[model samples]
Target chain A: MAGEREQPAEPLTLRRVAASHAAARVVVSASFEVAAGEIVGLAGPNGCGKSTLLRTVAGLHPCERGEVVLPRSRTPAGVARVALVPQGYAQSFWPWASLRSGIALAASGSGRGWYRSAAARAQSLRAELALDLDLGLRPYQCSGGMLQQAALLRALAAFASGPEVLLADEPFSALDVDVARRARAALRRFVRERGVRALVVLHDVESLVETCDRVLVIDGKPWSTDGASEGVSTARMVLNARLGSRRPDGDADAAAPTTSSFGDAMARVLGAGPHP
Target chain B: MTKGSAGRLALAAATFAAGLALWLALARSGWIGRTLLADPIDVARALAGAFDPAAPPGARVLVHAEATLVRALAGWVIALLVGMGCGVALGARAWAYVLGEPLFELARAVPPILAFPLLLVAFDFGEPAYVGTIVLGCVPIVAITVARGRLGASRERSELLAVFGVPRSVRALTAIMEVMPSCFLAARLALSTSLVIAVVTEMVFTPRSGIALGALAKEAQMSFETDVYFAVVVVVGLFGYAANVVLRAVERRLGLERSTST
Candidate 1:
């Protein structure tokens, strides 16, 4: 009941996953599943270990207990490849590289088949998403929204090289309403088209319910529990939004519940007393 | 030039003029004796004489500058490369950083100029000592700063690189790119310090049969030829300033001039 243990299609799986930061056990035994074609939303209060969980699944951080069971069967590289778009876009990007070069860097693969195709794919994604951007500018030259867009572009470019599990940490929090809508649309289209999964962290509950197929709510111990032992995660899959059968064009139409209904559901889950 | 640049230039001119006025007042009032502070006009004449072409070649500022530049540049360039190489190598692994830190600290404990006497004894008070001292003075800073550059990059950026699985060569290049600001700082510090160290080396060792700028200043000062001493000082300052200008221009061309340090 903790996860879809019966399903074996090999979507990104974290079984008994525990992650920590700077010696403080943050994710205390988190178990969840992100199935193919799923745009799973991770929602939680601040310091609830959402980012740490994403980072651990992406193979960027160390896992204390339990294993992250990455799907290698469906990947182009015959191994799990994850692209993490972290919260700090500016710091992750190579300050010295131009936007075009940064995208190209992400597009690169070990072998020749999918390496350095960022320009073409970026052009196509840009057109599909209706994004207006200049690839010649550096990260510092771009605004916050622009940089976030660039970070998204880089992750997607990496995804193009193979079937990548997209782990984005508040990837579009800085974008304006219009851009955010279009970007979400493009992300949904990409996941559905390629049958890949994405685990996107979102602080906005409305966006979480309206966009994600399933929402995983992260809950954790109080900050004072520094020595909280090996029991790592307290995350749960609480909501299945009637938000989509989700639209690929940012519309809240198909099988969509009322805005008030979705808001109440999110409120109930978020306002729940505490994870026992 | 832009308005800001023009304003800066005007301010620099005003400051220079003020310094000249203060120097003239001090000389006239005999507060700082002429033996200690040469008359500006006399210093200008001495400078002109050093470059007059009619003057003996041995006294020519060009000859001394050329000799010192070659010696100092040889050591500086070598040290820069060595430092960068060490930094890149050590920065690639945390264990390497831990292992190399002690050596870097030891190198830092002794300033490069202080090594001159040891080098002087080792090289029998010759040209090799100056070269050796200049290299010693600069390597530790360049290496330590370059090594630390890799550590300062945000984890998000590093995760991107890792997820993409960029080639080893690209990773090396990224390592280099992350540290450009530190590299520039290292370069600027090394360039400015090497010249001063070179001057000190010459004054202490006084090349037996060659043109050494610091030796000329030392000889002038010992004999109370304040004008000539000031002239050499001006030339040494000019050399340091020009090197900085050249370095700044290179960094600007690379578009790394405003890059943030680690």
Candidate 2:
């Protein structure tokens, strides 16, 4: 009788989403709700459709057979309110535009006069990010960390305009430990301050535990649990089990945890310890 | 200021002085014919004399320069606007590129000078002919640059825009801004090419209505006024340098360098 009870609909909803590449089809079907200010983490093995799911949610990838519905007050006017901060800092930015201009462009739509006061916005963003960059310098001139911070600043500027949801796909993939920690902290603070719901796609359980309120482990499919701090160990175990089962040849167990370097670091940070 | 800026300025000055010294030494030694390469002093004097109000002021130089500038600017503006628009369309769609690739490649391969005879046949040697030549030279360069810039914009960012429910105009503007640096660089190179074409077109085909500076220089050479010829050469060099400086300043103001480096 309890199992038969109808589930409450979410502000954002995805049902029976499926994706495919040239090689194979990855299927995903799940139902989840995210309230305002909630931080959700998605963890899974490599190529397990974690990033794919996030990309689909962000409208980057078209779903094979599913529906992604964003809350619309009226039935006729359908629009999803979401912002995505992609994985790579370098890829996310326009290499030609200055940090200030890029961020301002992200903040303001094609309204002619919105960009008139770009200088003031840029100065505030630079200060907020603790970046002492010459707003004149291009993307190529900055280091990786600097680019990431600049990107984060751009995302914050966009978020300021009240996008309901933020989809971050492996925000710390290439960053070093210290920088990643700082960035993760900043992201957490942003979610809290803005009261914006976030669905962060990551392979590392530790980062999820550190930054997310709930963890959704998509080993074979989507299996979610509340309290990411406590759920990290379970997530790691699920990841290890998935890796063990799918790993190739006699060296499968001996090949170690293959969930990316960032994932490995995250495991350590989440108290799952280093790869055994 | 910084030591680096000072050092660069010194290096530039030294190079200019060395070039001048070499020119003087060659003239003094009579290694090259004095008729062909006039004395620097004589060239300077001729330059001053040409500009003097008392002497029949050769406002010809200014007139020629203005004509060339007008042709170059008109052709460049037309080429850049049209080329970039077409390029964005092609760049955004693979099928468009495939469809237009052969025509673009063919047009780009044919030199503007070669196209001059065709224009002469059509327009019968006038401003249209010269402007047509410049447009022929510049459009391909701008189009290619715009195409490349559009290709270079991240798919991720475009998807982000879609996710945010941004309007079509907003998407286009963002895409253009993302590719603006490449477009600017391409436009600058195209401007230089357009200037060269303007001069060449003027030199080869002297219009009945206008005596272009390039034709005037040629006339001076034919009459063996070596100093006047060199003065024209100096004027051309100054104009080219000034154009380059202006373009660089515009590039800086638009944050083109910043986008390029990143």
Candidate 3:
């Protein structure tokens, strides 16, 4: 039943989106599609340009080659189709604007005259996350965790108005465990209800396994000085695995996986036993 | 006001009174001649005389005070607008900064007061020369401060705004709001500096009408009217303080803090 829903006729496509920073190609031609209501997890080593890939798709970072094709047509008002939850909580919001204002601004970015309604929705999302945040508090007044929740709420606010694609770069990195769980639940519900696609870059393999419908893992140092777009440099999906009920043990740190069982879970997500 | 602030205000008042008492005592002791240091009572009398409508035209302070105020305010407002625009442009564009910074540094290194003689020659030692002096004196500090504020703004937040496709007007508003605290501080600094430059210009240039606080101070000093000179000094200090208070009030009303706490 889940497989039928996962395989949508028209998925949101990225036809070889390639991005280079200065002389070095950071995201060397990544091509993938996230089906409707699908949460795709992008897992890789540090400096693999996971965030850069998301930014390229969002059209924030300049793409050296290729383009992203959204599944749905744009709204009549020409609102934004993609909402990005940036990696760092510190830079997610304007220091002068209160959390409520920040959320409203994000909402207003996608929809005209939606600030008031969006502010109300943000207030509710703060409550949903069980955050003890005064919506009136500015970004500097809030902690890293609270700012993370606010960032998520801002993205959710943008998504609430329409069927916008969500690209989250380590959304749960700054959040505590319980808050991360709640935020994940909120994200899932929003995606399910809105029928929008999401590509989440995550460092925690366990959460990626638990949250994503499908996982795409890239391996090796894909950057080179010679400007070659061959082999692993082009970021071909080395493994495309389906998520299953393959939970790692509680003893294992979610960040650092030591046991082979965790590796096996990753292998299960990757749909392979192991990679050399 | 909070109890702490109220206590602070009281302490400030007491400290001012103590300073006044010390000045009076030194003046009475004759350590400094009466011509050099006017007693508090005489200075108060001179203040009253200057404020009186019936006082002699040359001794009356209001006309000169108004001239000084108008020049200072005009120069300060012009400097603030021009400085903020230049600062934003320099900060937003790296190429502009690379080109403009060395020129700015060269101008900044020279004392602003020294420009008075050159400006007097250019603008003929009148209101234009004085206003030009004030502008030259204050613009660099305001521009540098505002540029620093704009540069220090969060780059990620800017990218976020771009991602949402926020309108250019909204983005500009956000940018201005981000830099407002620094701008307000720069305004205060600009105001005080403009005030000093205006008075110094008046004293040095000495307009034909002799219609400025600095002109009056110079006259009082030349005529040995020590009391009026002291009173003029006190009034200038009060104006500076009042200008700062007004800036603070406006900042509070706009919900901007004085410091860049963020």
Regions of model 2 farther than 4 Å from truth: A1-11, A28-37, A71-80, A94-101, A109-141, A160-163, A174-179, A182-196, A216-276, B1-14, B54-63, B167-169
| Candidate whose TM-score is highest | 3
Q: Tens digit of lDDT per residue, candidate 3, span B29-127?
A: 989998999999999998788778887777777667888899999999999988888788777766777787777767767777798889878977667
- Residue range B1-262, candidate 2, lDDT tens digits: 4697578669868987998889888887898998878998887887777566676434445556666678778898888888888778767777777787677767888888998988987997668988888898888788877877777777767766676555688778777677777777777888788878887887888766565766767777888988877877877777767777678768767656666444
Provide the TM-score for each candidate, comma-separated.
Answer: 0.82, 0.76, 0.84
Which candidate has the top score in DockQ? Answer: 3
User: Relative to the unseen true structure, what is the C-alpha lDDT of residue B167 in candidate 3, on a scale of 0 to 100?
Assistant: 69
- Identify the superior model by TM-score, candidate 1 or candidate 2: 1
lDDT of each: 0.72, 0.66, 0.74
Q: Give every candidate's TM-score on chain A.
A: 0.78, 0.68, 0.79
- The digit string of per-residue lDDT tens for model 2 on A73-127 reads 2213344346677776676666656677666666554244545454465576567
* Order of models, best lDDT first: 3, 1, 2
Model 1 misplacement above 4 A: A1-10, A73-76, A110-116, A159-163, A222-276, B1-33, B39-44, B52-54, B89-113
Q: Is the docking of candidate 2 incorrect, acceptable, medium or high quality?
A: acceptable
Worst 10 residues of 2 chain B by lDDT: B55-64
